[model samples]
Target: MAVKSDFLVIGSGIAGLSFALKAAEAGRVTLVTKMGPEETNTKYAQGGIASVFSDEDDFELHVRDTLEAGAGLCHEDAVRLVVTSGPERVRELIAWGVEFTRSDNAASNGYDLHLEGGHSRKRILHAADITGAAVERAVLAKVAAHPRIKVFDHHMAIDLITRRKLERRRKGKDRCLGAYVYDTKSGDVEVFVAGATLIATGGSGKVYLITSNPDVASGDGVAMAARAGARIANMEFMQFHPTCLFHPPRGKFSDQ
Candidate 1:
């Protein structure tokens, strides 16, 4: 059977959840998560979102820090936009009920940010050690409360359906129409149709024999996107942990 929707968002991470919240306001949204909505790399982020919230800190410094960390491959315009708009976006997160850590009355003045590795200033807005958890929880709660947003957990996407699926060459470059999903619970396949689809599935830390990513982090989105004519960049770039304890006693570390 095929399920239809005005907008479909794959993955329940920060990006997909945020997009779903925005899209649900205008039309129907179906959020498909491979695992539970709360299960994602975003939930394990020990660090936090970088934003220039204090008067002492600004976009220029943030940009410099990001560029330095990005080495030489960071796009200048993208860096500029991200650093410049980061603070407002952080504020938007606050409006979404993400309560970042505050201290020294800084939250009242602006925000009490922290300095992480590769950063020159304390521009990271965090919620203790589990900043990502706080953000994800807030967004997921809102997503659950939204009447127009439908959630499907444990639905793994097998591949995307494009104009090619229709065998229609006249559709030009072949746009994405929907996807083929495997329901983990039902042990069956389902075709989901959507007018618009956004892929927000996070990292591919599982490709490595030793990693710090969830079991579901199998690069599903990257694979599906590449199969759908979308270019997959940064495949060679990955995080490898040499000291990862793979024993059952410490399997949690390898599970990410």
Candidate 2:
């Protein structure tokens, strides 16, 4: 029998969980992940999310810094939208119990904003060196307690189901129905039907032999979306972190 839900979300990272939380307000949500919910790239991220939180920081400066970092490839509208809405989103995260590191100064906003490369001001809101982990824990806790959300770990998505796969008459436009999910523990493929499906499997860092990303960052979402005939863009834009630490600390730095 096929499992049905109002919303089927693949992967349990910040994007997936955030969407699930909002979707639950309207109807039931089913969240599936290939590994444990915490085993995601977001949990391993050392740097914090960039947001304008300081009085010294302004939206234009943040957007300009982001554009410079993108090497002229960023969409101005998208950059503006993110920069403008970031502070509110960060505040929302804090309200949800994410304990960000605070400044020792008594007159500050209590947050110890960190400056990163290409930024004009201190705007990164972090929780020590494990900001992503802190955010993940808080969001996961809220998701676990939500009665409208159901979680399925160790479930891998095989492919998306579309109207054509159902063998029904051609509609006005092709619409996604759900996906075929592989339950790793049971070694069975199950049908997960939903009114809407969201894929947030993170990046494709695992595609490279050497990377700081977790094992789950295997580009599953991108692959699945491509297979479903989605239009992919800017795939050539690959980024490498210059400050990543390699194993065997005593080994030659160049070898890493």
Q: What TM-score do all the candidates reach, one by one?
A: 0.92, 0.92
Which digits, one per residue and each the tens of the lDDT, describe model 2 over residues 53-94?
A: 777778999998999988888999999998999988988898
* Candidate 2: 10-residue stretch with minimal lDDT: 247-256
Per-model CA lDDT versus the true structure: 0.85, 0.88
| lDDT (Cα, tens digit) per residue for candidate 1, span 138-235 | 98999999999999999988888998768856446677888898899989999999999999999888776666777778888998998777877766
Off by over 4 Å in 2: 104-108, 165-172, 247-256
- Model 1, position 116, has a per-residue lDDT of 79
Off by over 4 Å in 1: 106-110, 168-171, 240-254
Give me the displacement of residue 204 in model 1, in angstroms. Answer: 0.6
